[model samples]
Target: MFLRTPPLTAALLSLALLYSASAATHAKENAIASAKESIASSEKDSTASSAKKSIASDSYTYANLHDVRVSHVYLDLTVDFANNALTGFADLTLDWQQQDADTILLDTRDLTIKQVYARRVDGQWRKVSFELAERHAVLGSKLTIKPGFQTQTLRIHYQSQPQASGLQWLTKEQTASKNQPFMFSQNQAIHARSWIPIQDSPAVRLTYSARIQTDKDVLAVMSAPTEPGTARTGDYRFTMPHAIPPYLLAIAVGDLEFKAMSAQTGVYAEPYILEAAAKEFASTQQMIDVTEPLYGDYRWGRYDLLILPPSFPFGGMENPVLSFITPTVIAGDGSLVNLIAHELAHSWSGNLVTNATWQDLWLNEGFTSYVENRIMEQVFGVDRAIMEQALSVQDLKQELQSIDADDSRLFLDLKGRDPDDAFSGVPYTKGQLFLMFLEKRFGREVFDPFVKKYFDDHSFKSITTAEFERYLAANLLDQHPGKVSSEEVNEWIHGRGLPASSPNPQSDAFLRVQQHSNAWLSGLSTLSELPTTAWTVHEWLFFLNNLPLNITPTQLQQLDQAFNLTHSSNSEIAHAWYLLALKTGYRQVLPALEQYLISIGRRKLILPLYRQLASTPEGLAFARKVYQQARPGYHPLAQGSVDEMLKAD
Candidate 1:
């Protein structure tokens, strides 16, 4: 993972030694237990606002939280599957840092407020006056409540609207086990307001506990640890000792079962998919073991993965304990399991040390991406990690060309814009390259320690870009002035385009594949002559992606005949093949491509297909036809992307 900077090799070796020594003495069990206790005691100022002032963000939340903080939250909810809504009460424990603070505001969307009450040391719930601010089209309404000065607890009884953006209610037809309905929540980038009333900002972190009552036939799971012996009682109690931003508060209810991969790691899916999920992610526990030395510890009690039905929006969400994953990655060949590494890395980068605001999202994603590659290199192989890195760079370059210059920068200005606009590959890829840049310049020996220290210091806290920059300056630059400078770092973080010092990712296997692709396109090699056996999915993707644009239908047919790519089971390879097929007018893949579109809801794979398919009138017709049928099976987030792409056409 290091370049030929003169001192880097020594630095890398020394870093490994340092990590080994420190990890040997690290008390992981104690740390996790202490964190849980701290969460139970509500001793953290986890809800402190970001270093940036509230005005710095374009969020609709009206409260100035500098004087008051919510320390912990309790959710008592009942799932009404018939009505597709949540009838619940949220009890927020507040710490009034300022004696003069009498009123507080929380964000809400499409929610009907039933009652508001407050209690103090006297322990009596008294009625509290509250007002709902005029709602914005996208930002939702703000619930302003007068809880009186120094009020310790504020409780609101409310019911979420059926159309709450965060909650997705699916019919039995949408699930793998067609006999049961499914429900899950996606609350990132401010959607939490749509389901639960809270200070919905990444800056505001708080410990939470939940009591969810669901149908007896369904299993209830949340971001917290599952309460014992409640599986059959229809009453589930869970607690999370670690404080997290509201967006990370997740819940799902379904006919689900768990299968353990190791003592502390496992998988959850429907009865039919459980075994495959368990096998597909068997490397997860090892990923955790590999990652602990790189960072300090896995503070989260247990790490499990929940494989959502096809329509789950993202590849993986780094939910504490349970990482919600898309079923598409269970390719049966295990080539896609690196996604598990990416999410597990978030246990440290995102779940432990979070970005204070969406503008600084790179802090969460970029670091996670880098750590993911490192873990993949250790647990999978170096070549596998290199292949993924090259793919990431390809994506980053394409994204840079397509997006606005300002939007391509590592530090983003998402003010007055939907934060989702900034959730592209830039943060994940460009951010990783930025860290790679530093590692190359300063050497891994010096850089690795800084990363471990960064997480150690910022664990359970949200940080801003400015804070990170200052920290880097104090830790890395001040100690080794000649290695890297603040001005050079700024060019990577704030300036547009890849910096001159950006890491050039090179994979030997990818290089050979590219050469073969060039030779085939140049008429120097025949398809039958190429060394086709022993190729992994990454090699196939490199070959397909590097194929000549505007390929002739004959060439596409030759490839299809030789590789059977149009019917490939691997989603990664199939996606690449389908895109080339569409471009080359290889009509044979039309049905398979359409079926692929219908079967998978991963935005990374489908949106690009839909966008490319919409280019021609006939293609647009087919895309629209498929979308009309597929829309019901997609999560709102995925549907929203496709809807806009089709709408524009």
Candidate 2:
């Protein structure tokens, strides 16, 4: 309706409409500003994600390899035993991938950095600033150095702490000679950062050279071949021309003597252990000789063995040219030299072509293990190889019972965890089995060439599991479509538990041993009636491992009396026997077990005993007591493992 309003009322209505229009304009402006903020946030997130993807895929390292990488390293160092430290200056040659990068990153643990200097192409060293980030429990610290974009080289002056996780310093009493102190480095599975300021990931490979000054009384050895006829003048120089992951960087200083097993192979040990170690590992040359035709030629110049003291943690560490071996494996006879074969196999599988990250550890270990069995079969016999394979399968099955489903897969996901945790039977044995499955299907006639090609193609390169999977598909699986399916291969690598097609490694020797073990357990035969005179170490291990869990203490005593198991010189057999004793509450072996624990620090042989003991209250007390005494001598790796186990209890 059209009606005339009073002048005051009309003026008020017009003012109200103007106020509403102003409020609407302010609300529209606010909405537009909020939309702009949201768009900016999304763009920022996208940029961050792209930058993260540009970084290397290795989860265990803090290195910015996308911007800069180490091409080569030169170390000048003094081994100061008085302070139990390594005083060194590392000269790192950088490969600047991004020309704009003004800084470089390194990994370190328990290191005292003194100074950092950078050099440009003009060759003038200039001091640079650096920062050491807060230390992490497992990953250690991130070292960032602002060397500037013009820098070509970085020299870091540093000293390792006495209690560095990578270096183990031993008093004279702890060594075999008992006359000279010993020091060795165990740098595998991310321990290299504990001693050296490096890009310590397996993905980073670099050639290295070193000059080490030691006490005039001792000898120095590294993972490189020894200089011919070099005098022992307290100065040692080493050069590894072939690129290797930092973990393979190893060193030892001790009262060591060398004995030649062959022109290209030898053994280094204390004076007392020299002759026996040489004799025990005399077949190392044969192992190398046999491995070449089946796999590839050994590219490393010389393959030598270093017999570390009893406190060496693992059975053997495959340190390129010189493999560090535990004294426990020198079982008087050569039965344990299979460990040598395993390490030598690493020349091709691990050292030549390494797993890019710890997640693909199976690529190194599994392939090496499979090649080890083949080498053993060539040097020893098929029976020995079969027996070892069967034992490995059994060990894998038992390990699977305790490991998580994801961890049991051939391709491990070890993000946010120590690579050492991946060092289990899953990678070593299960990985071998997966390869063996393919070998069984394709036959060695066809598979051997593929394996040899795989090594040759990837030589001196670090590779990821996905890259291997693709290579396998194109080179093997797709090439022979009907034999093995890609789905099956994926299941073996990614699925939980063993596949139905997994190989069942059978051994006639083990069967005989099992039959004898069963007869004794069933009370149908006496322990003496079993044919034990000609039994090998593998047979003995099978016999001990297959014994019933409900076996009586009296039966154990009788067996010990018959075989002298308490005094068994074979470490593997002794370990198995001690495990049985603990299970049955047989206290007679306690003293010997304690002595064994104290003397030999090989984790494979002793950790099982400690774990079995910690399962009971009394056993836990005993384990704690023995560990307290033994902990002083163990490598930091072994110490941490046992500590975590006992802490859990």
Candidate 3:
């Protein structure tokens, strides 16, 4: 079974405290190295030939592949969403026969497998033995039988309607077509098997073509480059020229409407959501404008977005051609559509340069997250881009808090495909943070071109962290010579937590948590109260934002009158004190609650204050209007305190 972040307040506090200490030191040391590199590079630039030779001596560039290319794959997927079950069949053709007879595992959970077949050297296919006892379906077979690395077709039948795959999700859609009932997939975690069976591991990728059959009225969607032609009897077939890993192979079907901007791309959504979907699609041009330059032109033909029901997990899955996004972002407002650009950038980071295992998942996530930052920068602005990275840094700290393991890579095995192990720190947040570190190392003058080349060379092939390091050193590392030691960077690729990685003294945030610590706090709350679980940085920010928006000025004054600071509210409050502070400005009252904010280590939330102080005339006017109309209400906090809160800032 998989374990999640610990359910302890201490662990949560520990994560934030320790993570920042390491990150800050790491950053400070990096800034120094970067400055030296800039000065050195500038001095050596005019000696072109010598500079080029010296650049060749550097060590941080990611390496190029000598072998290991996913030649082609064929996918036959069958699913019954209403029943939440799936069966899949696939055929793979590799360039060289694998000598190790490795066990290829598919990301799956709680599934019953009836059969499996693989083509053998005996000129016939046999029912190969497999294990389904754990979360993954594991298969071990030799390819020597196929000698020169011939074609191998595999057939696997499984059944399960998964809720947590992060890749495949089943939910009802409210769209225009009565015929198209919308449902989606979100296989970010290792849950691809709950819907389709293949080498569900990202380590083994294959060119995928999905044959999906949904309810007749419903339309089926996949990441493949092409669309399903007419319903063709009862089933529809969609194929792609790109090699796709199982996780990125998505399927979305629902009551859908199809509108085309041109022959190259089409939009899919509920009939009623057509206009809403359009707003998301409107940025298509902007996405192209940014991603093309970063990864060297749009290699994928066209991009489309499929909006799933509101309850879909995660923001979206980066399905190559057609991305499956949560309708939660389909709000008439455009703020949420940046997710589309994020997934779109994955066409390069995830789809093109794939990670070999979940161990190096940062190869997929970190790169994608970074590239998503690029897309946002170009499409939105530098402020939005920096803001997004800031969110990630915050999330990493929270995840560190949630994780019970001091070792972040415990779940990752030597080859990076250990499904049954627990997660280590280097996998997600830390991994991505490393990429940002790499950017600071390379700097813009040298980094941009290197990144562009990196994508261009490795697109459509699998890349490991080690391989990436080789490329970095051979290219950029030589340029920065004294930067990271090859040994140090290589150690990072295969190491546990950093040598300097350590926990910090417990933070005041927990001490400042006055919501449930009062002498009278015990009885007023429900038996089952839900504190916002700060799983990701966004959730943590939401928890912070939750404080201000829900509190009011009047309630603040009242709270001052009968102070429990910890006074708990049993009522299902629509808003909380902190949330109201966020909107109305808690400047004056912040001095009163100064100890709590400092204890929580959120003394950095001055962004809200800066916004208030720097607001343009028009913006200030809007803020004042919102402030004047703010209503007075109580949640456990007092009404008078709420009034003071609005006037404080």
Candidate 4:
């Protein structure tokens, strides 16, 4: 079954904005959607009145999951590099929680369902009756199947559409080798349904194994354990013993090779860059060692990293055993290895203990952020950790100024909206600072055990924010109410705006950078006189970000000539310089700025630059031109956001 949507016109988008202006309009629309959903849910509940059922996860998935419990999945797929798609079958093993339940609903998007079969109590598979529900713009379709009473497994044969949002196919020109094609999957925040027929919710976790067939010369890796010394025979097999949410099921197929940094930690890149990437990430095992003491053990057996080509969207995606990271973070000086720590921490907080739903996202991000700094402090130094925290605090304050006040809360009500829109520095930084506040009040010696205990109690389980709050109160607050109260904790978790008790993050290194920025603005120093010889990427960013918004082109020229930031190899520094160039209209750096925008496809670096350039007609035309060439290499997540902005008036 297939569903099609007409492309949106500028006039229609304007009309949409007008219609959305009224708060009542938003409320009424939500009420209508909710009522429709309630009627559907009511039917499912009515079918199994006596059997226990799980609450429906607050997600866009149409799965009637309350009556079924998925245990394992077997995926057999052929990776078609020429056509840029995955044609496969998924065999799922599940149990019916309610004896009378007779139907199964799975989530899918941009997928063509060819056939479905079920195994009966007689141990024979037979074709099953299935229906494709109506599709919403973002929610996709629900594949409902009527499996008879004694069925224990279902098999779905489907092929991903060319426009599958989770998959990105890159031509040879997009890679460093410039000779082989590449493809990868980005499935976070519910895009898994675009490529895989499964229950696409974090609230659902299951084990999976894969058999991937690709081109003879290409290598395929997944978020599961692979055999060492495997030959390139166009077929690869992987298995995961630990269960994970659908978003954690990832795959990459390309001209790639693996280099082991340790027995359990390694790096994957194209053959030409394998050694360099291995060297760059030599500290991965050390990070794991440091992280295990903070939380419990690293439950995931191996912590490997796949350094994808430049067009990968995010800084890092914490896939269970294999982390997909952008090449931009390989700054060659070991300055950006803290991102490794962050992803490694996710092995505990996000992979092992997941948020029950997207609304409790801070339960994953905030806890991971706090643990990331702890690992960085122990592996690196306290000063480096402080610098990272200070930068996060700076970013949080800036984010709070621009976003809705409701979005600033750690616990969010992201109903009737795309969960990806809630992603920002708010959850990471604010959650970390709130935990820091508790540590300050109760003291580290008292609170350290609680941190480890929380992870231990909830390992391998999805939890809501309320459950975490109850855990916090039962373990720490109830015993020592005089130190901190539940009301204060609520202010940080549910209330908007930063809490009064949030920690003040200070960095001595940034203090010096601020002084130089102040002196330059006060006319007491020339651009060449600033002491930046020992500055790191963070210091350079602070100096550039703090410059006055109304600075002249002459001042920018003097600074750019002195520092040569326009040609810097560091992606973070180059991104900062490009943004400043846009604000100042420093025409001299336009060529380098354009190169930066096209060469790096990381959404963190490019999205803001594109938005800033789209503010003026000439710049907008230039952005559109560069994007036309860059769009083929960009991931669908990045393409979706940039396409909307460029298409707008």
Candidate 5:
């Protein structure tokens, strides 16, 4: 279940080409270790997979300078909308290594390799088979066994309209973002293959240089920053000076008009978000304030973010640069800055120190969540931070009580989980809440510095569950003597569902609310009716969220009387009341609820409710059809839990 990997050597990555003797020795050792690990692990993995569908017969590994070292890659892509096809022209460098290594395979998905352009050290032109391509292409025509050569430099041409994966033509998912042109790539889950061809795995990290050509007005950015003099003719080029997993290789293109500002730390956001994104990013500065002091200096250059359309399923994807977030957070009201901060923290925990495989995803989720709270505590105050943590734990507990509580386990998989599950209660929130518990267990002064050490040592390398646990036990043993972790938490990583340790505040609150509501609702029977002023907004919301099993018609009338204020108030609670009133067929009071929905002002909530109402047998079909027709294209939010809403009963 685990891939064997050597411990990552201390960074032999020196910015200056000139190195001290010690540093040079370190670099050489690191390179040799990387090469040996690749060769050994590949061979071992081959032996292990020999009993399965094996690719070793034709597939092999060359030295990958992408991890632990700085290597540059450049590619030009020609994408055809008509055919849904792609062609890539790449110029990449292989660091100093010389041998009879001929089979150079790139991570390609059903791409056809045409021809390769390169100069052999022998100074002779020869045709090589760039052949043996089956679902993937090796990048050369001939196996030039040139020894004493330290690096390999070559250009390759690949063509294929790969299946929609990372870089997709998502015309369908773009409508929720105000019908603006939008696209997103969650490359972290190993979907980079559906887009570009390279070593498609996360283990082999690399520095990327890309020039993406698209229609004019198609703004561009990558997980990395754009290099100067590297862009041309709508070709958005980027240079990843830092080594990053291919999963973090992201690109978002839409008719984006973003303005930029430098926070001195790094450019915070592009200007396109002024109305919506800018407002959403209002609290983003707090994320910077809380995280920087704790995690040491920022690992990557400057942090930048982009707000995607509303259909974006996750709160945001931490794509090194330009973190793509859910468009819905742009409420223009700063109520949901916690989500903004959560994704921002991933820049350090998930982006910097990556989990080699999905199994060890807590290295990504748990750490990021913990850091999010740290950031929150700094900006929002410790009390608010603690309260938020309590609420998150409460949410996690409710999730654990679901018949499909195992679904909570999907949070850390980072693979095979639903797009909607990214901001899932378990992985992001509960995970953070767990970290909060750990913080209390250790206390801040001790826990805070340990977090910095955890990330700093593991940056740029892939880690597994075992490695994390070992570090946790070892690190904590050193600091919090006698501190021990049981199998309950760590063992939870391998399976689905929580570790039995997940909180359950919802059930507790449910019991209490059920009691209060039962008593309050029954007491209303003592009176003929409730005056409009009797039902407060907070009470109404609490009642709706904690609605009892079933209320008699008399009780419903009592409630209606309670909410029959002279003026129709417009608020979330008021909307709930109106919906309940309409549902109960309180013909006399339903008009106010209808008006309440109209007045909520969130343009996005209208169509769904209309469709649901129409679906009801007693509701007008024509009205439902009209609302359904207005529901436009592929916004994920627009498609959200429609069935769930319909099945609420």
Candidate 6:
């Protein structure tokens, strides 16, 4: 799923402004397209050469992949809960790209390297000399080892620091099962360097195997598929047969119990949340059943979910085979299962075919989001899917207003910046919009096959935006002449904002909800008279989102009184209501909001609330006070983001 940020304050105006582009805008687009086409025509050969070079260049990592590449990683690690660290050695099998190269460089962050050993072609392991380079604020330190010529493997013994960015160690009190501690890894976007010493670039794909030792009382899981009837002993083994990017490497240790949702799908959570999570996500098999016939077969053997504690930073991290999900999504009614669909779609778009660099993140996210909506439409009704799309578009428009034009492009230039900071609604939503444009122009009959073939052709590979464009042109656009021009595609990818021809998702359900919202805000009807009992989560979000920006405190109170929103069991509805309460200065909701912030640690839900609270002096003090108490429970990523946000305020 895309990183969730707060919606812009002037969402209604932003939506109007996005859709109502003036004639001059069209003229400018044509001019820009013509110029871009000319430049592309001139630089076609150089551009191809540059594209090949860029495919291997990743700004995020210090690994020199051109010299030596990592083929497979074998981790023999022990979970040390007392020290809040993982102490072990990683045996990395190397593929010598340059025969003359004798040195291998790997990425590391806040790790203490004790020793290094190299395995020669004769199968003898000998101690090797290594150096830890100066630390980089973002890229971490580079561990360089001179294993000598003809060495095919290296074993690096290291220990992770307590404050490693990727791994979060939670105290027993921070877990649902208060009797045991929990630890999980969130390694996307370069955080993997903090825990494991490897080529931490998405451009390099490698298979991995692990033997993780944890407390005998707790269960341990990895991104790899687990064998049926595996022993529950402290020593656990896993193997990921297919090669994947390092960021997809994941591990979790907790007092987890599993319940089968289907023959291949299951839920793993603490005893407290296992049943609820399983019930809420009972449709996992249906999602896979529907997605496989459209896309290719499910390449990864089994698809299971691990419901992490509330402190899991993202809504869901699409770790292969086993996805790390936040507990906040178990809303009892399964209203938020779209998040599941989004993550499952990543099985194809992201895990099977990945983005070569963070700059082309749209290749992973945009494709997944488009496929997610398709899955939603297939499983849930079209009305629900359209409502979700409309909400996404609304959020994107608001996000575009604040995001810089350069960052707004589907092809981002995040050379000197952190990819995490560069995230926004642009890649996920705008990329989806680009595909929707193509789908609309060339009907699904033509587009569906293309999507299926695209996934099949690029399975188990990392690709760049240029590579995808070339494939699209050859397979889809060129095959069906006069359907879409290269210029239009260029605009969607390289242009600052949405193109004039962008598809606008409209929902009849949201329209009716807006009508009721307008009626109540205009004083034509009382809140108690509105028909909300039958409303779904999507309808509630639309209703609350379209409420007038200047809604008074009394108006908020009336809505809360009638709907009991402040006390709603649904996390989505409660978050929307809390945002409104903060905006309207309704102090009655403060206690609930504070409790909500403390209990839930999903960045998407909590970041916006904290930002809203920091909008005023009194609220800022309250936010700080609450954050001090809530800080221990938050994951390192959440803690860092919230700290930066509050510090900036």
My TM-score estimates for the predictions, one after another, are: 0.91, 0.91, 0.59, 0.90, 0.66, 0.91
Q: Please, what is the whole-model Cα lDDT of each candidate in the order they appear?
A: 0.81, 0.84, 0.49, 0.80, 0.52, 0.84
Clashing pairs in 2: none
lDDT of 4 by residue, 1-649 (tens): 0111112222222323333333535345334223322322333222112134465366667777777756556687999977888998887766567778888888998899999988654445689888987777888888888866646667789999878988888878788888789989999899999999988888877766677889898899999866555678897776665667888999998888888999888888888777877887888898988777767688666778998998898999999889998889888888888888889999888888888788888988998899999988998898889988988898789879989999999988886788787688878889899999999999999888898898888776778898899999999999788999889999999999898888998999999888888888788997677888888777888888778889877788888788888899999888888888888787777788778877878998999899999999989999999999888878888998999989955
Task: Give the Å error, residue 308, model 4.
Answer: 0.6
lDDT of 2 by residue, 1-649 (tens): 1112222223223322332233435344234223322322233221111122233388888898888777556677899999999997887766666767888889999999999988644445678999999999988999999866646567799999998999999999888689999999999989899889999988887766677889999999999868434567797777665668899999999998888988888888899999999999888888888888998678777788999999999999999889999988888889988899999999999998899899899999999999999999999999999999999999989989998888988888876788898899988998999999999999999999999999989877788899999999999988988999989999999988889999998998888888888888888999889999989999998988888888887888899999999989999999999998898888999999999999989999989999999899899999999999999999998999899889843
Model 4 weakest 10-residue run by lDDT: 1-10
Report RMSD for candidate 5: 10.3
Between candidates 1 and 4, which one is better according to TM-score? 1
**lDDT at position 27, candidate 4:** 49
Q: Tell me which of candidates 3 and 4 scores higher on lDDT.
A: 4
Give the range of the ten consecutive residues with the poorest summed lDDT in model 5: 49-58
How does candidate 4 fare on TM-score?
0.90
Candidate 3 per-residue C-alpha lDDT over 484-578 given as tens digits, one digit per residue, 9 for 90 to 100: 57765655555555334321212233323335332214446531342433222223333343344445556455443443332222100111333
Per-residue error (Å), model 5, residue 11: 17
lDDT of 2 at 145: 93
lDDT of 6 by residue, 263-286 (tens): 888998898988999999999899
- What does candidate 5's lDDT look like per residue over 551-586, in tens digits? 566776665565453133333444455455446555
lDDT string for model 1 (1-649, tens) is 1111222223223322332233323253233223333332353333332232442343535545666667567787999999999998887767555667788888898998899987644455678889988888667898999876667677799999878888889888889889789999988888898888898888777767676888888899988765222455577766665668888999999888888888788888888899999988999888988888878878777888888888888899998888999988989989999899999999899988998888999999999999999999999888899899998899789878988889988889876787878798889999999998888888889889999999999887888898899999999999998888888989989999898889989999988888887888889999987787978888888888878777777888888888888899888889988888888777899888878888888899998899898899889999999998889888888888888889852
User: Each model's number of backbone clashes?
Assistant: 1, 0, 85, 0, 21, 0
All-Cα superposition RMSD per candidate: 8.9, 19.5, 19.6, 12.3, 10.3, 14.1
Q: Distance from true position, residue 205, model 1, in Å?
A: 1.1
